[model samples]
Target: MIWALGIFAGAMVVPAVAAHASVEDSEVLAAYVQARAADASGALGQSARLHGAALALDPNNKILAARTLRQAIAAGDRPLAVQAARILDKAGELAPDGRMLVMAEALRRKQWKEAGLQIDGIEEDEVFSFLTPLLRGWLAFGARKGDPLAFLNQASTNALADAYAAEHRPLLLLARGKKEGVAELAKAASDDRAHSQRLRIAGAAILADEGDRKAALTLLEGDLPPIAIAREQLVAGKKLKGAIDTAQAGVAQLLVRLAVDLNAQNAGQLALSFARVATFLAPENSETWLVTSELLAAQDQHEAGLAAIANITADDPFASTAADTKLKLLIAAGRQEEALSQAEAAVAQPDADADDWARLGDLHVRMERPEDGAEAYGEAIARADSAVPGSTPKWALWLMRGSALIEADHWPEAKTALQTAYKLGPQEAQVLNYLGYSQLERRENMEEAERLIREASRLQPNDAAITDSLGWAYYLRGNLIDAIKTLEKAVQGQPADVTINEHLGDAYYSAGRRIDARYAWNAALVYADEEAAVRLRAKIEKGLKPELVSP
Candidate 1:
């Protein structure tokens, strides 16, 4: 049976008859073309239905059949995905993605030989060339057939292949009881920084198995985000559990790696299917749960995303990151009060670290409790020491504290914190912009403020907020002409920004453009916060005072 997603508000509505009616081939093809265009624009559900409808009309169109298979997989319509796969298999026209769908289904059904055949039959073209060896190796390893590590090592010559091998090959060794592989695994991990997290997890597990529990604990007690399995367990002589314990779990881990890679490349919809397969195979794997939640959240399935994150056990080392993900998902879902409460509670926990404190501070600031935010940031800064085993004290923690203090109207403290951040990270554009903008707001150190802001704009020319800050700085210095020109450009880039619009209006009024000033103020009024809106309306009605309109 074909699946149809309900129409989105602005999405083009397909004819009701198109799906059920015995439509002409040309008409069906027309619908397919329109749907393909929409799909390219990210309307996956509508596109999948139209593709299904087109396949119904002309069942023998191989290209349409392949597209329907791919779209069905992307839409999470497993039944439709399977149905389309059958169609494509009959026509012998499966794309690489379609083949992956077939392979996932085969693995799900435990048809190991069939899955192996699917991997073997995948075309050795440019697109699949680099991926083929890893895919084949994983299948071989899962079936306990050949030396998969040899295949992985062969594929490691490629950068991406090396990263994948560095991530997963150690897991294979652990699974197969290959203690001898640890030395090689450690060297590979040290060579590739990109896969450090995976290597660390594998290395810790290997060390635990070697009876070096203390070393394993030391290996993991760093700033990097932890994987599942608690430090307490490692310290108590329990081995860290590998995600790939069984063949099915091994396949699932491979699928998860593929999904993560796809996600990094922004192929999120495609990544979703792989993640779904991974979760089904290894629900106990906390990383898979995190990836599944992230993919669902990316698709705006907030409730499902929350549930997925909630499935992670609290004792998992990755639980903190999962908690962080949950907070953001709640905020995105407009459950801000819940997010705030959760963040507050999380930071108050005994094990809470600098990142946790910083998260709480950010939440407080976002919820408009700037004073509370500054306190939380202060806690974060106090936690940043060698005892915690982080790489370095993050300048960002001080920067956030400083910005929150500025928001709370504590000028001297804000300046101190910001100066500390500047000394730590002089090249950071965000630090430069915020500190400079705050200086401009304070109406002090104009020369230094201008220099910092100029450098920030140079570093990030397209950042509308930075550009607006530069314009506001000009306006503050009584350079109405330059202010008008710069603010106009900033407004062009960020028209809906209440502050930018307000700045533009002030510039216009100072330059004797009363009509344009009123217009800009009205635009600002439309998007401004309540306080800003009140000020904007007053200017719109009573006009700017002489001081504001002065040269």
Candidate 2:
């Protein structure tokens, strides 16, 4: 069954349907497309239903068939996937779909031999080259059909063109109980700096097995991300990296994964470490440095984060991006002047592209340098307008300029920029809240402001600033009780956040919970600076302390 996703109001994109069709059928098809396109990762069942519908309608379409098979594989529906692949194989073009379908089914059923047999028939053709064989090597090792390390080493060398396969080979060998093979395979795959960490890890694992605990401990503590197979590698033999090249290739591979998924919280620390390793391995990989900086900034490690981001010189592939990130981080870190100056330097560089100018202007706005930021933003806007379609980076500049104008108290100009930001990224919670808060603070467009703030709150339920805004919005409408409850929840989630505590205290006082309010106020004072704490003490003294409620 093809899966579908629930519609998202923030995701304004209409699902693209198959070219043209009858009006009635088109609407139904569009709904299916829209459901499939919705960002519901767990709605695989729904997405599968849509794909199935499309496949049934266009049974002759190879791409549609392949898509269905892939979806089935992802959903772990082996019977459905096998059905699709068998049909494709009958169609005479076996483009890896059937191969993976068989393997996936075999893996699901734990049929190790049949799984190995699926990829075995195509062993000679380098053109049939894929990662399936390397995966099979793992299955074979587990089955004890051959020497695990030797099998993986030979298969991997033949399939080394794919970077992912290359990295997995050494680990697979470790899994198969071959310690010395690790060092040999590591040497072959060491040309890519992004992969060096895996090689080093494999080497260390081999040594630990030989009872060289101290040597293994040193290698295990090395900068590489921990791999599950390291334990097995040590069980095999003695690890050695005395001749390992620290500057080997493939060290940056981990950083690349993080860059592809910057919002992945679990990968944040590992990404930062990989970025550092990449920076150490290949100082020339400026893009890796920028990715590192971006990850740090996203994690709110601003000071050192900005330092990582700002290091990208103009010669790098993502120089403008790095410089732009640096400006944002500086602003986020509250080092506004430094952000402004950094922007200035970026725009001034001789090789600085038009993007550099726009990015610089946006930085100015973030730093509260309105005139300069506005001017720079305008240059970027003009460049974006003049560029080829899909090439103009207009929307972000427009939004930044608007934010800058808001800071400058230029109401009309700010509104225009805010609207532009909406057009570019309609679902952005921060932009929605910011615009809504501005309108509320100015005491105009009250209804629209409330709606926008509510929407923002829905999108970011746990965000401290958004939660505070929702509570305040409620307060504005005389919903004092709701304000108190909402603000208190926000405070609880972020106990260390001064903003949340202050807002909660204010809401409590407004709702006539004077004693409860006093306790919150006192707590805030305890975490405040000496001068700030002194002033807070007055509020704590004036308010009554409420009695504890029994559960």
Candidate 3:
């Protein structure tokens, strides 16, 4: 649930103050300037002087008063805080937070009634509606003055968007031993669809408290939309086919609404709790399980989530989604063997779709099982090639296949895959650059490789590696003059790239500028890895002697 009012707590600006006769007051301005400098250095001593100076310059400025109060609160100077609060009070206006700080201190001494009085004293009751009522209810709850149930419930209802009020609702009732009342409230809430599904679903469990299985069944009998109805079943375990059916139209829409409301109202955590309950109730609801799985993933509890997905059935529409979730969980948990096995099982499924095949392929690639990955990619290509543009698998599969082939050390095959992907989406300069660089590294296709690399650099001129690759290709072709110039350009574009700097150093040496070459190599040595640094260091030590290069 999003707390709309909570947003009001931060950075509400005070209108800027107009300069007054005291603006140029030397002592005050000097204090103010000193304090500004102090603030930059994270000091509080200057805050006091600055407050005094600002107030002196403009006695009527609420901005000064508010800043003084806030700074005093941060400085741990109660006397200054009291002084600032007094100023706001004397002006017949108040900041919503002004008195809360003082009241908090008063409560430390068991001055409960005093704190309550302080809350009532805030001048702007209308602006502080939710806060004032909630605070009063808290004080009442602490003092055990009657049951705070009535007060807190009223406050929660009035402050619908207030998280504290909502969370406090069950607490107040629970302390009063109102299990029956809470259960009764759930029963009564059966008519409010906004909160109806929650009530009905919780009915069976909470009704167990009332020993009324009949009422639980009655509440569950409503022609509730698919999502709510499906979720009712989701509680059976974790995964469910019905979860997808429920999330289809009306019920799915409601879930999103409820989810967003819970998120916006700061009830996101509460929503998660409720979602868990909902999933528990309808354990067969795959959609609900999916939601829970995603939530668990976001919370970094992917392992337990895989267990939840284990409840899904083969006939479920969302079964593959559950499989994917399990695969991801296994991967995240470092259970690569399990993920690979699961991928193979999914690949063998008779109804496997293009997406399923793609996922299988990607899983293989992730595990460094390139041959298997390529076979899975092949299946996806055969399947998706006949689909419409939007239904066709994106170029990513081709890229993945290409990458797998590269890792398999099949340079020609990798080139073929990459070239196909490039032509499909030729504008991706990274792809173009990688293919070009790969060819250059192969050392057997210099001219065509140079053409591709130069084209990539032209498209993405600021890209450091593409520029470096073009320059490196030139050097490999024995065009030392052009290589030196282009590598120098590459160095200018990527001053921090150790490899580019190293290449520049080599270019300088090849151009017969030994001293300049040594300087560039010295710079490269400072940032290069141990191996590169060792090579450069040896080069420097040898002076006129040569150093061996390694692949």
TM-score of 3: 0.39
Candidate 2 TM-score versus the reference: 0.45
Q: Compared with the true structure, what per-residue lDDT tens digits does model 1 show for residues 1-551?
A: 01132233113434432443355745774767666665655566667787787777866666566667767765556667777887777777666666776776787677889987777766443555566667667777777789988888877679876766765676677657666555555565553232345556656765677676655555465444463244555765565764354556666666787888899899997787777666666666777778878997888767667877887876566666677788888987889999988777877788778878888988888778999999999998888762243312578889989999988989899999999999988988888998999888768998789889889999888889999888888888888888888889999998888888889998888789999999998888887788777677778888897534321
Residues 1-551, candidate 3, lDDT per residue (tens digit)?
A: 12222223211322243333245545444444454454444354355556756666666566566766665544434566667766786786656556554454444344777766776774245544554555555556556565555555656455442554443444344334444445554545546353444434433433434454454444455433422333444444333222111111112222333444555566544344334433433455455556556655554556646756777775454455566678888888788888887777865888666767878887888777888888788788777754322222346667767878888888788898888878876777777777777887677677887888888888988787888888888887888888888888888887878888777777777778989888888878878899878887877666424343312
Residue-wise C-alpha lDDT for candidate 2, range 1-551, written one tens digit per residue: 22223444212333333433334546545544654563144344455566666666655556556666655544334455566676676686545435544544554455767767655643432333544445555565546576543544555455333445555555555444545545546554554243344455545544554555555544443222122224333444424322222212222332344333433556564444445544543455455566666665665566656656655654332344465576787788888877667667765776555566777766665555787777777777766654422222466667777877877878898898888877776687877888888787776888888888889989888887788778777766778888888877777777776555655676677678787777777777667776656556656665523321100
lDDT of each: 0.73, 0.57, 0.59
| Prediction 1 TM-score vs. true | 0.63
Q: List residue ranges in candidate 2 displaced over 4 A.
A: 1-252, 255-274, 280-288, 291-317, 325-354, 387-393, 423-425, 522-551
Error of 2 at 479 (Å): 1.5
**Where does candidate 1 stray beyond 4 Å?**
1-95, 108-110, 124-126, 156-163, 179-195, 206-221, 225-233, 245-254, 344-357, 379-397, 419-551
Off by over 4 Å in 3: 1-332, 387-396, 478-505, 508-551
Candidates sorted by TM-score, best first = 1, 2, 3
Number of the predicted model whose TM-score against the real structure is largest:
1
Work out the TM-score per prediction: 0.63, 0.45, 0.39
Ranking by lDDT: 1, 3, 2
* TM-score: the better of candidates 1 and 3: 1
What's the CA error at residue 497 for candidate 1, in Å?
14
Clashes of each: 0, 31, 27
Candidate 2, residue 354: lDDT: 52
